[model samples]
Target chain A: AQSVTQPDIHITVSEGASLELRCNYSYGATPYLFWYVQSPGQGLQLLLKYFSGDTLVQGIKGFEAEFKRSQSSFNLRKPSVHWSDAAEYFCAVGHFNKFYFGSGTKLNVKP
Target chain B: DTAVSQTPKYLVTQMGNDKSIKCEQNLGHDTMYWYKQDSKKFLKIMFSYNNKELIINETVPNRFSPKSPDKAHLNLHINSLELGDSAVYFCASSQRTSGSIGEQFFGPGTRLTVL
Candidate 1:
């Protein structure tokens, strides 16, 4: 079965530090990969997505993700973490019209 | 303007009661979906409608029924709601085509509490 995995359940990062969230997926073909963020009392927002061409895709809020086919990974990265960046992040893989989401990772930023 | 919107931001109801949550999208997307976020915060897709046609239905119970009145509206109705049904339900929309795939736009979720 196709699934997405976010190994870390919770992560804490100091303000202004670099941040990386890992995601791995299992699928037969090259899949449409995406990263979504959900803040407190808010809906999920699309951060970035990878379709066909470039491995590295830049998204809103200064977030980026790279899709590595070899490892079946699409990891999200940010250069400097902001206090407002503390939220829940979910990685999803899209096949046809359905999306398989990973158990989200919660980020806590220390001021 | 909100791209996707769901009515009743918060709902508190008793068990064995029937309730419905309405969702609408103004993004002109053809596909609309309903997802359930459990206490563990794991989001699982429940149902999806494409152009008023049921396309994807997960292993959800028969008590859960979805209605699509039009291309822009999708409603979820739950029968005999159980305590386990207390969770946040989200509605999302996307534009799917042969040439390009669109990112889903989510609505401010409706937090349902079955007491």
Candidate 2:
């Protein structure tokens, strides 16, 4: 079965420090990758997506993700983190009309 | 304007009660979906409809039934709501094409609390 895995359940990063959240997926075909962020008491917001072409996809709020097919990974990163960046991040794989989301990783940004 | 919207931002109900959540999208997408987020924040897909046709149905209980009156609207009705059904439900929409599978647009979500 196709699934998405986000290894870190929770991560703490100092404001202004670089950040990286790992994601791995298991699928048979070329997967459509996506990153979504959810703030406390809020709905999910799409960060970025990778359908084809460029491996490095940039998203809103200074977020970017790189899709590595060989490693079956699509990791989200930011050169510098902000206090507002504290939230839960999810990785999803889209197949046909269905979507599979990872458990999610919570990021805590410290001032 | 919100591309996707859900009604009843928060709902508190008792077990055995029946309730429904409505969803609509203005993006004119061809597909709609329902997802449940548990207290632990684990997200899972429950159902999907493409152009008002059921395309994907996860292992959700039969008590949870989805109705798509049209391509732009999808509603979920839960019968005999259980305490375990307390969670945030989100509505999303996307456009499916041969070139690319469009990114999904999510609503603000409806937090359901069944006591």
Candidate 3:
């Protein structure tokens, strides 16, 4: 079955420090990758997505992800983490209209 | 205004009870979807409708029934709710006709708790 994997279950980063979340997928063809963030008591919001064309895509909230086809990975990164960035991040892969999401990684930003 | 909205933000029911959650979107998109987020915050696609036509149906139990009266509305009805059914349900819409990267707009989820 096609699935997305997030190696780290929980990650803690200090405020103003750099942050990176790992994401990998298993798919047969070129996959459409997406990154979403879910804050406490809030709905999931789209951070960025990679479909085709460029390998690197920038999204809202100063976040970006690079789609590496050879490694089958699309990792998210931020130069400086904010306290509000503490949320559950999900990596999803799909083609056309179908989607498969990773279990998710919870990021905790400590001062 | 909220583009996509769901009713009954929180629901509590007993086992074997039947309930329904309603979702509506004003995005004017061609496709709508239903997703379930478990306790672990893992979001999984359950069903999807494009212009009132069923498009994607994942591995969900038969007890869960989805109804779409119009392109703007998609509702989920569950019969004989089980403990496993307890989770947060989200409704999303997307422009399926878009050329390449189809972006989805999601609504505030409906959290269901079974006692």
Candidate 4:
């Protein structure tokens, strides 16, 4: 079956540190990839997406994700991490209108 | 403007109770979806309706039914809610059938707690 995998269950980074979250997918066909962030008591906010064209995609909140077809990965990165960046991040693969989300990684910020 | 909205941000009911979560999208999308976020925060597609036609019905139980009265609205009704059903229900909409891979917009979600 098609699926998305987020390797890190919990990631901790100090303020001002650089961050990278890994995401790998398995599907029969090329899928539309997306990264979403969720704050406490809020909805899922799209961080970035990779539909086609250039593999590197930029998104809001200073986030970016690179799509690597060979590796079947779309990892998210942020140059500088802020305290507010401490939230749960989800990687999803879209097939048609339906989506499959990963287990999610909870980022904790250390002061 | 809010693209997708869901009513009853929080719902708490007994295991045998029945409840409904309403979703509305102002994005004028032809496709609406219902998703379940489990305790592990794994979001899974429960149902998808495109132009009022059922496009995808996941392995979800029949106790949970999705109704799309129109393109902009899709509601989820759960019968005999169980403790396993105690998770966040999200409403999302996208332009799936428009021959484009438009990213889906999600609602704030309705967290249902079955006691």
DockQ, 0 to 1 scale, candidate 2? 0.72
Question: Compared with the true structure, what per-residue lDDT tens digits does model 2 show for residues A1-111?
Answer: 999999999999999999999999999989999999999999999999998898999999999999999999999999999999999999999888788899999999999
Q: Rate the local accuracy (lDDT) of all candidates.
A: 0.95, 0.95, 0.91, 0.92
Worst 10 residues of 3 chain B by lDDT: B96-105
Predictions in order: chain A TM-score: 0.98, 0.99, 0.97, 0.97
Candidate 1 per-residue lDDT, tens place, B9-109, comes to 99999999999999999999999999999989999999999989999999999999999999999999999999999999999999997833568889999
Clashing residue pairs found in predicted model 1: none
Candidate that would win on DockQ: 4
Model 3 off-target regions past 4 Å? B98-101
Give me the TM-scores of chain B across the candidates.
0.96, 0.97, 0.96, 0.96
Cα RMSD of all models vs. native, in order, equals 1.0, 1.1, 1.4, 1.2
Lowest lDDT block of 10, candidate 4 chain A = A92-101
User: What is the lDDT for B8 in model 2?
Assistant: 92
Which portions of model 1 miss their true places by more than 4 Å?
Answer: B99-101
Task: Provide the fnat value for model 1, as a fraction from 0 to 1.
Answer: 0.60
Model 2 residue B59 lDDT? 97
Name the better of 2 and 4 by DockQ. Answer: 4
TM-score of each: 0.98, 0.97, 0.96, 0.96
* Per-residue accuracy of model 4 over A1-111 as CA lDDT, tens digit each: 889999999999999999999999999888899999999889999998888899999999999999999999999999999999999999999876678889999999998
A22 Cα displacement, candidate 3 (Å): 0.6
Write candidate 4's Cα lDDT for B1-115 as tens digits: 8899999999999999999999999998899899998888878889999899999899998999999999999999999989999999999999865565578999999999999
